[model samples]
Target chain A: MMTNPGNKVTQGQFSFLPDLTDEQISAQIKYALKNHWAVSVEYTDDPHPRNTYWEMYGNPMFDLKDPAGILLEVNNCRNALPNMYVRVTAFDSTKGWEAPRMSFIVNRPPNEPGFRLLRQERDGRSQGYSIVPYATDRPEGERS
Target chain B: MLDAIAKGTAAPDESVDLQAEFEASNIDEVMDKLDRELVGLKPIKTRIREIAALLLVDRLRRKFGLTSGAPTLHMNFTGNPGTGKTTVALRMAEILHRLGYVREGHMVAVTRDDLVGQYVGHTAPKTREVIKRAMGGVLFIDEAYYLYKPENERDYGQESIEILLQCMENNRDDLVVILAGYKNKMDRFFDSNPGMRSRIAHHLDFPDYGVSELKSIAEIMLGEQNYRLSEAAAKALEEYLPIRMRLPHFSNARSVRNGLDRARLRQANRLFASRNRVLTKTDLITIEESDIRGSRVFAEGKLEGEPETKAR
Candidate 1:
């Protein structure tokens, strides 16, 4: 799940897997396509620290023509995140599906870690996309 | 004979008859049977369980001189038509009865016609009869707002509404009333009857099915009819459905069922045209892409790219 600082993700938003690398996200997409498995992804534009989950179940429909621009026909999605903008991180050629990757910027949030915080536009702003660490076992100081 | 009579505890067989008492009770068995028949509606099921718990707690409290009389529950179901409102209401009646809330589990379903009589002088009896039937169980009124339509200046519907209000108040202990309709319509209905609104404590909203949900529903229907959809066909159908599902009516599960029926017919026609007397699994089971076709016109009876017709 993706959460941000300002907006609140409603019950109709997509519930995406959190803190995944681009490689991992791609691998999941490939696996889903091969197995014909449906997946749920969370997408959010809200800058709130807490994340909300909205469910969407469908196989990935990949469009290779536009690599950087990830677009798929969502079979069923909750109304909370209607017409939500998202970027895809992974693709499986065999299964014809893709999964959104972590660190994908929405509404011009920078992808770099230290640079993200510096790029903050105004008061209560951060420079880059501040990625939330997912591992619970790791101590707060140990996380990047 | 005197010696035998004097012996108060003669044998183990002379003790309390536990086996006979166990055989006489049937509450647990009835609940188990009902549970198996009720499917889907997990949230509603949880709510029902919660109500049952409250009722039990209230009963115990009363028995221990801590509480009052029977507790009445009110529930509102908002969903598209044929999404199992009436079916669930029927099951609820049985569950409530088995839980000892009411005497019998009989359910009475009504529309505006059943409540509001045709002419002047006929409204009260009609309303009363509906109340009489739903006394001990549930009165599930579909589109309940039509009871207050403004068309009739005499407005006999108001008479029916008054009677219904009285019945609900007087028979609160034994009867459960459920009003169901579209979300906006139901809100308006509630607004019209402030007294009825105050009594309804529970509200359950059922969302419209998305394309994938519709696909799953379609697949379930196909399986029930001993048929299936080819992979490509299924994907195509799913893609096509969402594009057509812009309208509220198009997104309904019932509409998906209708589409499946049409697709089945198309498949049957193709098979018959081939002059094959024997239908194989490949022929009858899988729904091919050819079996289904896209509609050029939208649900509102307008061509996809056509200009709107101006009103005269």
Candidate 2:
């Protein structure tokens, strides 16, 4: 399968994969629900790794026994943050588990302007480097 | 230290091309990654290349029916904290996996507390459990010298060590146990545990990163977070290193990471204090000189690393 390295949103599982269809998303939700994992929806204008604390759409739908409710919320987030990055997370309620059990990108902006690897040769063969996100050069709201 | 990559046999009259085998092994890609990700561990890198070359030669030897038993892959990675020992170990696992020395290239990093339990009849299971998880891959014991505590006559650490030694001997083919810690301490550990020393075929010492190397690591961290230092600010960071190193508890790369994080915070505070003005893209992304100068180290005309903050 052909893959675009630039558009590859690497935050979560199955991210290098193409956008998941509603059926696939729903299937994943069902799996999480079956395992008693709390499924929450979050979206962000910034997809940077350091800025992963995405604004949650609503509190985690921990008690929503039905998967359709989450599907509806995810669609709403997609509609609201159309130009931003939106993702879904499944958190295990088991004690001492701080990390999300599963997470995946649900929606992404069409124009995914990726980060450029900026290398500056300092002294000799050793190089100094920085990650420059192209889109962030523009203001937050103005970024695609 | 691997013995199997090119397995089975070539035809009686056929020749095996060394170049072809190297290309097929994908070990070069692993080596490339090691070079890119790790900053300054020259001896460790050379040892890895030597080991890989030896394994490649062993495969060729096998094709000619000059067979030898699987070599012991156990190792001792000694250096100071934050000296890329774990990073290099991870790469070593990938190399081993790609070259058919292991089933999975994943690394299981553990400490003494993880392997040795507090009470009686607990350490064997704990150590064995860690070993089981580390099967088909590499087991990295950070500060492994802690596992040998001879001060107490009846310490549980020895049980863990004994179990580990058994696993290292029996599962030489599938498992790789790497003992890692400070150089002098590791040397002492070996003197006490001659069995471990004898079993270990290779010892790779990770050297501490210099000021420039630490600065480069900080730059890479900055890049990952989509931030950059103004030219003067970068200079300030360079100046900050030597002063910081003179202080206590300065972990090489890790301290640099914390320093960058604090610098970013100061930048945020500076930007917020002057929020009335219209800020440009550079204003937001660039960490200016004042941001780095805000560090308490700068306020100290004489004192460095005194843990006192400059009260605004």
Candidate 3:
């Protein structure tokens, strides 16, 4: 199981996928529109396992209803920074919050370096394991 | 005008009921209190007015179909203890509520103890509960620097700070947070957590009250209670303040308040121990020089003072 190529960075709602397709992104946008949520695109160079906040490409798009319109923005973001990780986020204003309720990865770098598990030995001969992204362990420019 | 419309009375030129309602809810009274009630800290008062003006202008701009954005209402209050930080925070809540920036205008003050939990897996819910209570109002965190003690690895305060940072970003529309502490400690706090620093928009430094300002606070406190300080008593206070201020744990306004309380107690004791058969009205309400001079709380330099380095 550890050697499987299906190693994925489990983070937000749809982290199981390696990279979402254009059709899947469009479907998610449609769901957001049905729920009256605003869609936005965010990208980041350091997609560390613990990093939750990402820089938004622009403000949340409140007027767009068609998934194709959102796809254009997403594709543009992907093309602009092909090496960086990019994702689609949906913001909800319900329940007195302006939180990103749903987010999923749409694009990732070519060489997906996963995580490294660390082991710590205790005084009683017991051990502990900690998982951290291998990319963050290196310098920013050398992540890819 | 909206109130009039909702009342089903739309007379563009005049509406007496609407005018009265507007006058009642106007923030001018709250603003006037900030100017009148608090002593010194002119910069703090001015900063508050500037924020209020910005919010007001944003509202008007929105009405006119102009591009408007919500100003970051999170603030950092840096001052010594008893420097009117909490008072200003309360008045700020009232001002924001009147301006429709906040819903309730109430302030829930907390520290690390109230936000952080003692055990593992218990801090998030505790911090979230405080955030929920502070919703639609202001969350005033005193000695906020304690929320992050990098020296203590086992401490749960960092978890609480993380949760607070998240809420400060996600719930900016309805909630206003004010983190208050000494200038140096708060600076170090933001330094340790650079991400938390960027989220805060306003930084108001509450300067310590001068000797004269503390004296005036004392006079006001005594005057409000129908107690008059004699000429000699006032002189004693003026002299006492400068010396007390030089010592460690010199809380500006709070020390003055404590001094006044001690003077009042001494006056009561003096009256009861008097040889006169009957005490006159003047004797009952007057604070003599002896009353102000006799209390060694300031002279002893041990009036349950806050630590010079960290607030306890």
RMSD of each: 31.6, 24.2, 16.2
Off by over 4 Å in 1: A1-144, B1-45, B59-66, B294-312
Question: Sort by TM-score, best first: what order?
Answer: 2, 3, 1
2 or 3, greater by lDDT: 2
The digit string of per-residue lDDT tens for model 1 on B1-312 reads: 323322432343333333332333334464454455433556766777677667655543443345476665767888876465666677777767766676556778899888887787888767765665566577898877677766656889888878777767766765788877778888887887788788778887766666666677778778888989988778767655665576445636677777788888888888888874777779778888767553332224334543442311
| Ten residues in sequence with the least summed lDDT for candidate 1 chain B | B1-10
Cα lDDT of candidate 3 equals 0.79
Query: What DockQ does each listed candidate score?
Result: 0.00, 0.01, 0.02
> What fraction of correct interface contacts does each candidate retain?
0.00, 0.00, 0.00
Among all candidates shown, the one with the greatest TM-score: 2
lDDT minimum window of 10 residues, candidate 2 chain B: B1-10
How would the candidate models be sorted by DockQ, starting from the highest?
3, 2, 1
Distance from true location, Cα of B7 in model 1, Å: 31
Candidate 1, residue A79: lDDT: 40
Q: Which regions of candidate 2 deviate over 4 angstroms?
A: A1-144, B1-13, B304-312
lDDT of 1 at A76: 19
List TM-scores for all candidates, in order: 0.54, 0.64, 0.62
Candidate 2: CAPRI quality band: incorrect
Q: After superposition, how far is residue B302 of candidate 2 from its true place, in Å?
A: 2.0
